[model samples]
Target: MSGRSDKKGEMMMVQADTRIVDVIRQMQEQRKQDRQIFYDIYSQQEKRQDPEKKDTGLFFFRGEKKAPFAVVCAGGGFYYVGSVHESFPHALELSRQGYNAFALQYRTGGAEVACEDLAAAISFIFSHAQELGVSTDCYSLWGGSAGARMAAYLGSYGPARFGGDDLPGPGAVIMQYTGHTDYTENDPPTYACVGENDGIANWRTMEERIENLDAAGIRTEFHHYPDLQHGFGLGIGTSAEGWINDAIAFWQAQIDES
Candidate 1:
């Protein structure tokens, strides 16, 4: 490891082999200035009613102030949260593109539980959007694998359907390598990407999703990468690299439509 002076004129450790976990750890260590973590977002009634609600939270990786944001959920097959692989890398890339991004930690029993936490996280963000210096209009929902299911569900059914306030659906939904097949004509504009060799989530399933979205009159873009696997976060050196830029372009188009 080596140390270098950052823009703040403070020395920071530089890792020779940088990884997404390293970036996220750096952000966590520098949370005082780099990231904001919101803890335990249950409403007063829910907190009082269900005394055992988990303490999952949201980690915000900010970009341009007042920019529309994307809420990213990582995949863990409803058992764990893979933020290191799926959330932080995506958020970091989105931030690099000048978009505010949040990586959410949801209760991981299943999609239903995870979606509830996502809904609460979105509600929390919306409630404090002004203070957070983010615009609520045309924000995006991004997820990978199981998390993609959560994002897709919310994109199809607004927050209110999942016990949150009746907030507008995300302007765009970015899904990566998930077997999410459900769709509606009202689904937000979607950008989907999958690897031809993704054993976990079939490329054909994603193709079907795109077909359904297109048939239903939803604006969508689908990319099929060659020789990539399920959880290729940020794509790094893989064939799926640079997909985030295309997703951002899709999101910007949605904002323009708004």
Candidate 2:
């Protein structure tokens, strides 16, 4: 098993053409086998009766006791199909780095419950810090695109605050190509590159929220791949290795600092 001090971190390769629905099903099986931790935390409308369903299948990865444990969220637009290969790979990589890493297949959508799921996931991880061999007090949220949006939302408004004297939330948050927010000069070049796809024109209602999070002192880091589109950081297509390396570097810095 790769670990923090080890040169080779945990690695995952998101397979091509895998759909989100299947991912959800696979996770369900894992849950049944009792090999998984944390809850799926979705709703009825998101499941049966709706005919067509979209669920963020959750995955958990544990590691040695350490600060800045990770709650990784993968970017699936308000609807990122579960790219387990893209998502869990990163979590496993981080775990091997010796931090408790969780790849949350959070409920996707603008539902109020979905938002709750995000908060609940972090709270759940922290809720059981000891079993995972870490302190719940310190953790970081890492996500891309849709996952990034949710992470930023939770990071900004979810809880990770410092107001109530020892606020309950992750100490760090990172965005690979977070959509669903306005642009800023400090945004990564990728953001500028995806003008039409992830452009400022893309989000109008949530700009204020993004700004508010900044104002609240949330440690937000935005990375834009000027040439890569929305899911650039997902380690898909031709850039999987580079994406993983970039993610490893990004995550390692956060973990060590955490």
Candidate 3:
């Protein structure tokens, strides 16, 4: 909410209950700086094989150069990319807190395809870390709902498990409002949150996932906010509003450990 005051009028266009897609469209329409909001991740030849690939890109909200970076994937239920609500807002907040953040826009065919895009995106960032002014030494992966599933899958299985190049797992994983419970032994430390009343992404399931991760000896932190709903990005004004800062601290602790 650091810079939201400047965009108060534009932000008032959407309410807490607004659908994520509508909110994203409104944000995109009100965007003033185009250069800060768009980035292409695939080459023309790659897009030629799948026209949807042309839409795939990464919108970066940069923080301190050479700091550990985060790749954020937004939730769209495998039907759309909710970059405006889930991606950009989270990335903006993380950047404000001095963490390099990238909001990924990937093909939306299904979880598998989206995960492949995420893996490739991570590989691309690592390959160009020096030029991008980001450090590959201790990056994190963050996601919401379906995107959380992607993040968890990548953290547990590594990028090579998907179709992308073989790469080291992220140092940490941050998930929000996801029902995905699958995990592998010794997965990356995780920080998760979900609204108690969220119908789409069950908070109970998330709790169970956390318990399981803890039982497996993976470091875990979770928060269940009272009376909140799904897709509450950065949880502004809600009980979960400050959870991003907490997640950042958790990620930093992992970096320190590494």
Candidate 4:
């Protein structure tokens, strides 16, 4: 890493459990192939109006043209955006599986601001779907830790609640390692996973939420991997390894039902 790359890497709280290098390599490959990997969700005028929006954008990992898309948000406890460790890799994997994927780079500081950025990002993608070559239908939202709360909030209340346009929420919401318990009767179908040993976000909290969703007659799936801890991006090589596949299936099931 050097220059801007090094600067970006410095912002990441690199952990032994994360595959930051792999994400960097994949991003490099995408750039080498001449793909437009990043898109500013906010226009220049918007950024000028609110300088905080300058860091907000979407990093794309393209799949089949016009295929359904997903937006992945990485968690950093609202202090930083961990897209390299948590989101970019997931988007790359999703693209490999033939789904257009985007890793969101949102402004950090507070939950409300983050959710607003997410809503704005969703609106940006929807507005540019045709030019971006992605289907507006059956799109999903994914996130880990604090980011999971953002996804769930948007899933429950919708983008309009967060200052975005009146738009349909995701067909599914995939959450990881978060203890968010909020829900609404109209929340999208949801799939969630957490590590039982996660000290920051107790697995019981997640399980209880899932149970509540089920009791409310909402489509849901929950998984808790024993002995694993928090921030296990992709859970690769752990008991939670391959969990993303299960989540993908859950999302697909929602699409089928819809």
Candidate 5:
């Protein structure tokens, strides 16, 4: 709430149902500005030779007037900045479809220890929902690969470095080739799998972790395109459209149920 640029309010419109096309335009502009700000900040820090200054950027998309918002987390190996060209498009497309979309940025690799950056971002979303124009009550996390792992950890109410008990878990999720834990009796959580190919498919070690959450009646939808690989959710290389479509449907289904 403190640092949110007054500029955001200028672009936001209280449109009916918050259309996707208009939202994407605003989100893209915001993303560009945020990235540039971070880039320059890092540039200055680099000149100063401050090891504490991180180059990883922070950018979040915005929706129209929707109470519940959809947040997108881009996957980076806890090692590097996630793909903006690849991951952010999902936010744009979702905004076009009438969902407030945010493509979040977090510390990458071991920048701030291990996963502290991601946890901080999650906590920020929860604690600052009012400023972000999102409902603290409902959140749907969409991520692929490392993003998926982070999302799953946040969604499952699992132990996070920042802790999210103050923030409600995602109402629904779209997991594609995620990796957090083995799909076992205790993990791999069944309710979240729209299991694509590889990675999250660690069923051999734990027989589909998603089943457990599904059994608990959590709102979850699974989609699989065996032709896909790790970063399918970004809608990048092969079968990207399939991943987007499936994720949208999953989100829609959950929204309907609510």
Candidate 6:
């Protein structure tokens, strides 16, 4: 289905990229191969305790068993989740690169709640790493826009700060097109990209954050694509094309160092 046709409420900046359809087809192929694609991060009891969690889950894209994993969170300005346009395609691509990937379906309406869900999701994956055939080591977090803020916050402060387990932060954090300005000396290695023409998220803010990270002695990679705007997922046919590969390389470099 086209992203335009599948658009839901309050979801702005939805990209009409063909990668969405390709990812959906790949999901079907995975299912046909008897793979379980969707998993609930919250148990039935947890959902019953807080009904808001009923809308949250994870969509798995398998690669090599025991490979490092990444969690991709979609941008929706903290009001909704644009996973179809943002996260799923990225996860599919990551899986093809032989890394286990999960697209998060997080509860929206606010950033705090959403980040709490993210922390919980990370805790769940770590708890079930053996069963899921994933390596907890060198895992990464990927997100766009508001989702970028979520990943950055978690990367800076950790899951324990968000009421989850006292897990170590990701090896790397990949963020796209966000104005988040918070960071610390302890943050994970970060890779950030934004379009020069992105009005909603001023590229300068992103640059400033990267500058701060670098000043703090944290490794960072930043890219500002000319003439592109916000939410340009995968940046296909644009100057931002092939950026994900660069981010993956950055993540791999961190893994190697670890």
Give model 5's TM-score versus the native structure. 0.65
Q: For each predicted model, how many residue pairs clash, with residues at least 3 apart or on different chains?
A: 0, 12, 0, 0, 18, 0
Arrange candidates, best lDDT first: 6, 4, 3, 1, 5, 2
Assess the local accuracy of residue 187 in candidate 6 as a C-alpha lDDT between 0 and 100. 94
The number of the candidate with the highest lDDT is 6
Q: Which runs in model 1 stand beyond 4 Å of their true positions?
A: 1-17, 25-35, 43-52
Question: Candidate 2 local accuracy as lDDT?
Answer: 0.51
Weakest 10 consecutive residues of candidate 4 by summed lDDT: 8-17
Each model's lDDT comes to 0.83, 0.51, 0.85, 0.89, 0.52, 0.91
Can you write out model 1's per-residue Cα lDDT over 1-258, one digit (the tens) per residue? 123213211211112125555665758765756445554577667767865465577777778999999999999998899887788778877877788899998887788878988888889889989888899999999999999999999999988888878899999999999998988889999999998978999999999989999998899999999856677767665667678888899999999989
- Give a tens-digit lDDT track for model 2, residues 45-93: 6466542334543566656765457767765555643446446656766
Task: Supply the global lDDT for candidate 1.
Answer: 0.83
lDDT of 4 by residue, 31-137 (tens): 89887888998889989999999989999989999989999999999999988778988898899899999999999999999999999999999999999999989
Put down candidate 3 lDDT per residue, 57-167, tens digits, no spaces.
887777898888999999999999887778877787787788888989988989999999999899888887887789987789999999999999999999888877788
Regarding TM-score, does 1 or 2 come out ahead? 1
Better of 2 and 3 by TM-score: 3
Candidate 3: clashing pairs of residues? none
13 in model 2: Cα distance from truth in Å? Answer: 9.5
Give candidate 4 misplaced runs (Cα > 4 Å): 1-18
